[model samples]
Target: MTLDQFEARAREFLESRCSRRGPVATEWGSGEERLALFHETTDEQERAEAEAALAWQRERWAAGFGWITGPVEHGGAGLSAEHDRRYREIEAEFDVPDMAPLRIGLGTVSHALLAAGTPEQIATHAVPLHRGEAVACQLFSEPEAGSDLAGVRTRGVRDGDTWRVDGQKVWTSNATFADIGLALIRTDPDAPKHRGLSMFLVPMNTPGIEVRPLRQMTGGASFCEVFLSDVRLDDALRLGEPGSGWKVATSALAGERRAVGDRSHEMNARAMALLATLAQRTGRADDPAVRDAWVSLHSRLQIARFQQQRMQATDERTLTGAERAIDKVLLAANYKLIGDLAAELLGPAFVADTGEWGTFNWNRWLMGSMGYRIAGGTEEILKTMLAERVLGLPREPQEMKR
Candidate 1:
């Protein structure tokens, strides 16, 4: 179909659901402070957001818009990637419900499963995820294995037809609400760390699994710590060959980095607009030093925006895995920089809540920005990967774990 036809079809579908978004309110001391990097939601509020997002996704699935670029045999529209991009561009014009809750399932989990799952697994688990019938979360990080994924200590011992899992996963997003978890476990202790691991799909409601929310300094429980004790799963739940866990885990991490970059531009743009207003209101707009910092940040952010647009237009096959790290690192640094700018603008007021409109409320954003640096992948780790993989530098010596 023609691009115009595609636009018309998407517009018709969106118009039936919601009206176009009006101009954003940018006035100082107006509306919400909204500076938090992570969502600050009560339990009730979180559930409401989830329900609204799921409802919208289910409708999109029924109308063949949920999985635009997904395969036809897997319950998707089987359209081109361009069609998917165009639909999202059009969808942005309308006031649709936020789909942040479904991002892990759609962006990270589904990509990894599609790459490594069997046909039956794809149809059973991946399809429901794309259709928004169920939510999935990755269970990769452990207390000691945050960035060093190969060091994951979660154990899985085989029985007759089931594997007994026992380990703890930290920093798992959406675990409290996820229906399924893609868990990485050590299946063979005698093999090398990377080779001994395996991936599995565990039903979240399994008998011996527990999810406890981890509250951040920003007072948001966006991540969870999960414990699995004697959790048993059928062999069919295994994602790939016993020793291919590294391959399957990296697939999801790559998707996560790209997704992080894709979603960051808009958030950064909004912060820039708000910070510009903050500067003028606080009389720092005319300061030469403030101006210099603002310009530098602005230039870097604008370049990052252009880089992302170029990537979106380019073919995925032409890109390298190292390219994904660039966006993640760029945005992560920008988030901290923006937080610093906010702190400078607010000055001493940034330390205390004085009931001022936009002053002290920015504390959440600054604290939360630091989390992004460690999320997706740590800054130190990604930079090393870029140096060795992208720049052809000498590899860093790995400390032998004997």
Candidate 2:
């Protein structure tokens, strides 16, 4: 079917299936409602919410909506970039099921498998991911290797038919609940740091794998720490050539950075609206400083949206590593600007647990606003990347390896 035809059908399907008691049927509308419900849910309501969300995704996957940019052979619709963008637009208006935890696996590793895995591996794993039957998480970052990923000490020793893994990974978001992990480990310790690694698809249920949720300042379990001890994986589960794992890992990270840029556009819009609400409620909408801040934030948000749209529009996808740094910088700045404005506008109300509409919530944004910059790559790393790579500046001295 044509892209338009598919989008129309998807919208109709969403309207028909979404709970009427919640928000609109569009993706964002539905997502906002679902997020509110998700955040406010009690332990008893969590399962019911999760099941409802899962069922919604199942329906979309069956109808060819969940995997638009995916390979045609792997149960995705195999549509063009425009088709994917259009689908996301239609999806934003309704409160639909969420799969944020699954995105890194399906969008990144599934594609990586198509690029580097044996055909048998793709056939065995890709379709189940699209159907939301399994979830995947990354096992790259370690206690020692945050931004300096090549410094990871995770080891995978060769066994007769399987490899034995032992390592620890930190900031492993969603690892505790994931079905599998895309682990990168040192298969040849004597080789150069970046050259000795190998990638493996390791089942989370393996006997030696342990997952512990790491709570954030926001009181959320969005990140975790993982311990792998003598976990075994068949050679067939390896991705790419044994010593060429950096290529796979780099490809996955590049895709992740680009995806972050795209998603930030929608997120910025919501942030602006929330700020606007605060401005109007506090009678700050007419203040000169508040107006200037709002305008500045909106301008940056628009530029981010345009850049993201341009990146998606190009078939070759020209968002290079440095351009991604630019996106990250803008996202960080926008978050801080919006948060500051919201906090300022709320004034005395911001510090109190007023139980009012937007009072206590200010603290969440105030604390979490800078998380994106620090989480993905630190601001210093991004600035260095932009200076040395994008602007052709001289390289700085290498720091001591921790």
Candidate 3:
């Protein structure tokens, strides 16, 4: 079938599924969404609710929508990227499932692994990842190596056919529940920091791997700290050459950075609808200031979609590293702008538990806005990248190399 036909059929299938009396869950079946689902429930009830939502996702995977862009040899549909995007558009309208959690695992990590992994490596894990039988988390960030990712001190050493890893990763999303984790660490500390690194797929359940969830401003554990204490992995699990972690991570991060541009488009329609409700409820619809802000918000939302289309029309590999950095900066700024518009329209109801309509649900956006500033490279770092790389400015010499 044509791509258009596939999307149409996918939507029809989703509509039928959404119409059924499926399990009622939060907005996205995530920590942020859990507050909405079990607004007032015991821990046991919330756990059960989360499990039910995950079960729904498994059902969708079985139906073929879950593995749309995955390698067909690995139990995926082996469809083109456009097909997956169209299917996501259809799937988003209904409550069939929320695959945001899988974006890093499947979209970024798995795709990168498939690109860089050995044939035996692909044979062992690619299909399981596509099938949702495995969940993966990125182990990239560290206390001293947040924006300067190459400065990672996490160390790995060769031990016969296996490598031992010891490192600390911070701000790792989904690590607490992830089945497998893709981590970058220093395999040869004596070499230049960037050249000494290697990437490995470490299981979260492995001995000496500790995942501690970090609470956000909104009181959710959306991020975690991963500690690897002499964790070991067979050479078979390595993604690329011994010291090619930076290259591998760059590719994976490029995919991630590319994916960010689509975030605003995902929830903009729903957010706009909610904004109108808030405006009317607060009697701000008549205010000229509010109207102007609303107009600006709508324009930004459209611009985000347009940029996405432009990026899609070209081969992503043709994009410069700077271009990817620009995309990350734009995505974060657009989300913050949207969050600002919401705060203006919704007021303090966004933070306080006022029990007012359209207010309580905004904590997710408020919290997520700040996170956008930090995650995927902080705003400051992205701006520096734009200046140094894109603008062709002189680089500062470092004296600490001794």
**Model 2, range 166-223, lDDT digits (tens) per residue?**
8899887656567777888899999988999998888889998888877666676567
- Over 135-218, each residue of candidate 3 has an lDDT whose tens digit, in order, gives 678999999999799999999999999998888999986676677888898999898888999989887899999887676656
| Candidates arranged by TM-score, highest first | 1, 2, 3
- Per-candidate TM equals 0.97, 0.87, 0.83
- Tens-place lDDT digits, model 1, residues 274-376: 8999999889999998999999999999888888777777765577767777888888889989989999988999998899988887888889888888889
Distance from true location, Cα of 385 in model 2, Å:
2.0
> Which model scores highest in TM-score?
1
lDDT per model, in order?
0.87, 0.73, 0.73
Q: How close to the true structure is residue 192 of candidate 3, measured as C-alpha lDDT?
A: 82
Please report the TM-score between candidate 3 and the true structure: 0.83
Candidate 3 collision pairs: none
Which portions of model 2 miss their true places by more than 4 Å?
19-53, 316-319, 399-402
- Each candidate's root-mean-square deviation in Å? 1.4, 3.8, 4.5
